[model samples]
Target chain A: MIDWALVARTLPEYWVGLRVSLLLLFVSCATAFLVSIPLAMARVSRHAWLSWPVWAFTYVVRGTPLLVQLFMVYFGLAQFEVVRESAAWPMLRSAWFCAWLTFAINSTAYTTEIFAGALKNTPNGELEAARSLGLSATQVYRRILWPGALRRALPQYGNEVVMMMHATAIASTVTLVELTRVARDVYYNYLAPVEAFGVVATFYFALTYAMVGAFKLVEKRYLRHLAPRETGPAAGRPT
Target chain B: MLKKLALAAVALAAFMVQADAQQTRLRVGVEGNYPPFSQISPSGQISGFDIDIANAVCAELKMECQLVQQEFDGMIPALAARRFDIIVASLTITPARLERVDFSAPYYDVPSQFVARNGAFQSHSPDALRGKRIIVLRNSPRAAWLQQNYPQNELHLANRETDVYLELVAGRGDIAFGSSVVSTEQFLKRPEGAGYGRVGEPVRLQGGTGGVGIAVRKGDTETLAKVNQALAAIRSNGVYRQIMARYFDYDISPSN
Candidate 1:
């Protein structure tokens, strides 16, 4: 039932689409990493004025569908006369910039919540120990709190990254020609949903596995001390 | 920040009011990206041949026309969901589509033609374009025709009619197939299209059933009859020809 010849002939096109998908994934994830840190801090802050706005942002963003958010950014914003007349129109008019901004902002909301939840759960004993040792609040956060929270948040954050990769498929609605778009085009031309979607399914499956594998490596390195003592034949062999 | 908040609040209230007031107006669905047919202008207003036709029909029927922007592929589903009363997009009548919804008499008919760079292809025959990269609009009759007749050719399906020409110009494909009016008026007459020209005779489907029509929900005889009457009224009056002249130099009526 597989059309290997069709797959071979169209692999190059799919590869180009894969590159675009990866570009969107990596760029948006990197930007989300940068933005979510401060947002997460504000989310857990003592000041209601500071925390409420960030809370509202995450609540609204996370509550709405990403596709609606994307359309609001890419198409709805352009519907305004003021937006078109503004200097940012040049940048906002580009599909790549719009997709990147939408993905990054959407991922930031979810990541911020993950990081905030981890931050709130930091052990009280750790904070007491740091204060008793005379570490200033800044130093304590920099050295102990941030590191511990980040390490705890890593697994959830990794899932967010994978989810963002899947979310990149929606960029095709604005004409980015990513992996799902390529598969759809091929399906349209060939009228073979089975073969076309099979290829896309395989690509996404492999990508998800690779992401999970990378996260596993990270967990091994960073959370090694948390692992139970190795008791297998090869346990005592490694450094 | 305060001004922006107030503006957003007002916009939200306006949307709520509009949603509540939908019963009295006629909601017409249109794919606003297809130039020369139905396009959203820079001012965010819908324009072009299909928009004008829809407006004229609404006027003839004495109903208020509120055009709703929709993607072509989702037009039928949206209609079934009652998001719109009728689809006035440049939707061609096809047997497969007739299974889902009913179509009024064709408002206009245009031939499908192939476009390529100068001297790229001699003809659109299966033998001539066997190994060529061909681009066609997704879910279009032209795409169906290509797949049925020239399955060996490398086919690239574009989401929009404009993208078909873009793929040809970008060297991703050797030829593109779409509405002759769009390829000629929207692309070939422009400066960027100087190197491209029509490569073959217009393609006619096996059943000779290619014509653009307005679609309504299946078994909605009252709306369908009203739409047909409006279409006939416009054709007899000079409104249809006047709208046609704004977009096309040659005749696009069914006879031509």
Candidate 2:
């Protein structure tokens, strides 16, 4: 049986936690988007020197669990004497900074791989057309490759965003009061697991759908060219 | 093959029932990270004051004690869900917790204290530490106290008792607030805790008695009575004292 009264009392705390989770999600995703563009380009490079390092970066980050990566950054780095006394200790001491840094870097690894895959799938004809049109290498990437590959990567990138949102729950381990921590605190205080965790589950469910719906609209707009054309009588009809 | 597998399943079920009938198994929940009270040794054995007391109580009650290690924050919920019958993890008896779980007679009482780097500040007053981060274990009596009293100070709630001091040593917090015994024995006496010492007087809030008790699910009077009886038997038979001496030079038996 769910306790409605307990849920009402804790709803405000969950809202505050939601705001924190949202901030962490958006900031990390935005940063990963910017950083991954270059890393992903490097990943698909012809030069082994550039490609291998990017490959190694993605391999190392994507290979390990995100929780372990977070712990190493948040707790492990603090173990070193030089790190504690360093000029950057001010920022490193902050749980917010450490969590955001870890999430963004983790997101970058996965996003880089996704974008790189999309880049590899670029139609050879499109590249040849851009080259024959006398477009420079920079112009080719900016005008043709990036736009088309980003459209291809949109669906997978949306998944990464949602995953990143869920991953923010681990922020509670570093002392950030995100949604999971709020639920846990409620559960701790009331011993009402149903009301505590159930409410958080509902919040996550709603957020996930909202994100999925938004991505659907974006996909509809950007990937319209790829959508199947109207068939039979509808193909010849004028609106 | 199907007939042989069915026979093996029946035999396994019968053996499990027989094993269950052999002894009254009691699952005891503990936070293995709280040093001096409960901690896992380098060899992975759970040993400390709380563990010894739990084992002695089991011996007194003639029950088989099985330790279930869990994080301190989840202890009460796990108890309510029957993940364990009782908790012996140095859980302080406070009014907030009493509403959800019933606690046995006090086994030990210790004061809370603040530990900061030597020469950080002498006072633990809110005015002195305003805007400074103070680290305490999440869901703890100290955290509750700081939230209510030190409204101006920033509170950093660590997931484990050990992490309270770890955060302080890592310069993540300006002060560490926790069990005086743990701060003294587990932190100040250790090499990493060098240059850090108690900076204020002891605090006993909530019920103000600071009794640490073995907890059972609310309305579980049967287990509560058994735990209380076992505690009394161990105290009278010197088992409690023997365990106490191993962890502390000072007396910790609750003063009634």
Candidate 3:
């Protein structure tokens, strides 16, 4: 059974946690989106000099667990005396900064791969048509290649967003006071896992639902051409 | 299908009966990361002051001691969930924990202290630490004390007790507040803690009974009594002192 009364009393704490989780989610998502574009571009580059390095970067980051990466950034860097004495120590010392950096990098790796796959899957005919229009390489990328790939990448990108949101829970281990951390603190105080984790699960479920629904709308608008032909009277009606 | 289910239930009952018959086995939960108190050595052996004490108590009870390594934060919940029978994890006796689990009579009462880079801080007063980062284990009584007493100071709550010192040594935090036993034995004695030293006097929070005790599930008075009896036997028979001598130069036995 759920403890509704405890849930009512802990609304303020959950609110604080929700704000932290949202901030972490939004900031890292934006960072990932921006950074991934360029990295994804390089990942799909024709030149091995550019694509191989990006490929290696994503390979190393994606191969390892995000939690381990987070710990390395948050705790591992501090183990070195040089890091402690450096100017960057001020930023590295912050839990928020470490968490954000880890999440952003992790998301960047996955998002880059998603976008790269989408870019690779771009129709050869589309590229030919863009070149035939006398568009330069940059113009082709901006006008045709990037837009089509991004539209194709929408559904998978939506999945990455949801996964990143869930991954933010690990930020609590570094003491970011996100939703999971708040739930853990509540559990520590009340010893009621049902009341603590159950409420957090609801919050996460609601957030995920909203994200999924929003992604659906975006996909519908951008991916309309890929959808099956409408079977309306004006469409395939016999003369 | 119904007949098979009934037969399976009968088999489970027999298994439970056999498990209950094993009275000699004692499953003890321990956080094998808290040095001096408990830690797993490089050889993967779990040994410490707490491990020795638990072993001595098990010896007295003539029970087979099985140490189950667990995280400090999850000790109580694990105990409640029957993951382990008792916690020998240097768990402080506090009212909040008392609400969930019953504790044995205080086995040791080590004072808390603040550790900072030597000569970096003069006093542990709020004014001196104002705006300075003070690291402590999250959800700890010491964190609660700092929140109440030193509101102006920034509190960085690390997940593990060792992290409190790690963050300090990493220059992330200006001061570390935690068990004196751990701060002294685990950190200051190690090479990594070369520049750090205790800066403040022994701090015992007013929130708890100010003693560390073994925790067992609440309402399990039978196990509680046995643990208490074993503790008394160890103390009277000099086992407790022998173990204490191995770890500390001073007496750590519960006062009063």
Candidate 4:
């Protein structure tokens, strides 16, 4: 029922698709980390004006599907005369830039959720310890709190990272020629559904496995320190 | 328990029988985003000349047609995937595409045209386009044409026909290349289209008049002949002309 020959023939094209996909994953994940740090801080801020808007933004973006958000950005926003005239139109006009921006924003929303929770669970004792040593508010956050929360966030952040790797497939809908799009082209050309889609599934499997593998290296590298302490309630007891 | 299993089998058999009897259910593909030739209404139903022609052809064959929307770039691939049985999309029959699939005799023709911002000068080859930003669909025949001939022109491939026009209007590119069908329907019809204009005379160059045709997977002789018969019926019965007038301001060369 599946066309393995078609899969074999389209391997090179799918490889090209894989590169774009991997690039999108790397760029979006990296940018999401940058964007999420600020958004998570604002979201978990003490002031309602700061936290409330960030919370609402996360809620609405999370509520809507990525497809609809991409459509709104790629198609809906282009309908306005001013957006078409803006200096950013050259970059925004490109499907690659649009796909990159959408994925970055979407992943940032999810990563913010992970980082926000980690920020809350930051060791208050560490902050008091830094304060007892005459560390300023900034110094406590920079030296003591940020590193602890970041290490705590690693495992959950790993999950969000894998989610973004799969989400890159949706980039094809806007015309980015990524993995799934290439397979669909092969599928249509050969009229072999089994072969075309099987190839796509295989690529996706390898890609996601590689991503999780890479994350494993990152996890073991930085997390080697956190591992000996992570056992039970004692880890979260904050002192 | 055996009787219950037997009953379930019979029901499944009956369902399959009904589905086979519904062969008259036609599935036609079109780029509903491309107007006049094919376009989708706000309610999400496909309409315009190509849609009407597909319905009439299906009626002549005594089949109930279902319209499916596909992007211009994906139309051929989608049709080949058997997502639908026939492509009523304004697809041009090209030598490269023909290698992979079968096509019915062309139903209509649209000339390929190059368009640029109002102030730009016209040159036929890439030497003039050299260092100039030119827009075309990636991997389409026209893009290939430019790559081979005017390789010097910087190519900016866009996904949709409107994207070409939008970017050109924004001065993002020096020129945009596409079918006359898209240029006439979207750009020339709009008031603000004054900023953009077609270059050179609309000559039959490069890919020729670009004949539009229906396509299916190769070797489906039964499907191919049946579609031909229905298309022949539409042309003879004047239904094709009726559908044509409903959409186009002028008649395209169907005799080709």
Candidate 4 chain B lDDT trough over 10 residues, lowest sum:
B201-210
lDDT of 3 by residue, B89-199 (tens): 888788878898999999999878999999989989888887898999888888888889898888888887788898887777889998888788879989989978988
Off by over 4 Å in 2: A234-239, B1-33, B39-46, B58-85, B123-131, B206-209, B233-238
* Docking category of candidate 4: incorrect
- Tens-place lDDT per residue, model 2, A70-158, is 99999999999999999988999999999999999999999999999999999999999999999999999999999999999999999
The sequence of per-residue lDDT tens digits that candidate 4 reaches over residues B60-128 is 999888888887656766877778888887777776568767888888876667888665866546566
Which prediction has more favorable DockQ, 1 or 2? Answer: 2
Which residues of candidate 3, in runs, are more than 4 Å off?
A: A80-82, A85-87, A233-239, B1-27, B40-46, B58-74, B81-85, B207-209
TM-score of chain A of each: 0.95, 0.97, 0.96, 0.90
1 or 2: which has the higher TM-score? 2
- Per-residue lDDT over B70-169 for candidate 2, one digit per residue giving the tens place of the 0 to 100 score: 9876788789888998999988787778988999999999888899989998798888898898999988777877888998787888987778998998
The residue ranges of model 1 lying beyond 4 angstroms of the native Cα positions read A231-239, B1-108, B111-256
lDDT of each: 0.86, 0.90, 0.89, 0.78
The order by descending TM-score is 3, 2, 4, 1
Per residue, candidate 3 scores C-alpha lDDT tens digits across A1-239 of: 67799889987999999999999999999999999999999998999999999999999999999999999998899999898889988899899999999999999999999999999999899989888889998998899889998999999999999999999999999889999999999998877788899999999999999999999999999999989887877776667
When summed lDDT is taken over every stretch of 10 residues in candidate 3 chain B, the lowest stretch is: B201-210
Best by lDDT: 2
Q: How far is candidate 1 from the true structure (C-alpha RMSD, Å)?
A: 14.2
Model 4 misplaced stretches (Cα beyond 4 Å): A1-5, A38-43, A47-102, A133-135, A173-175, A184-194, A216-239, B1-33, B39-47, B51-87, B95-101, B123-127, B191-194, B203-210, B220-243
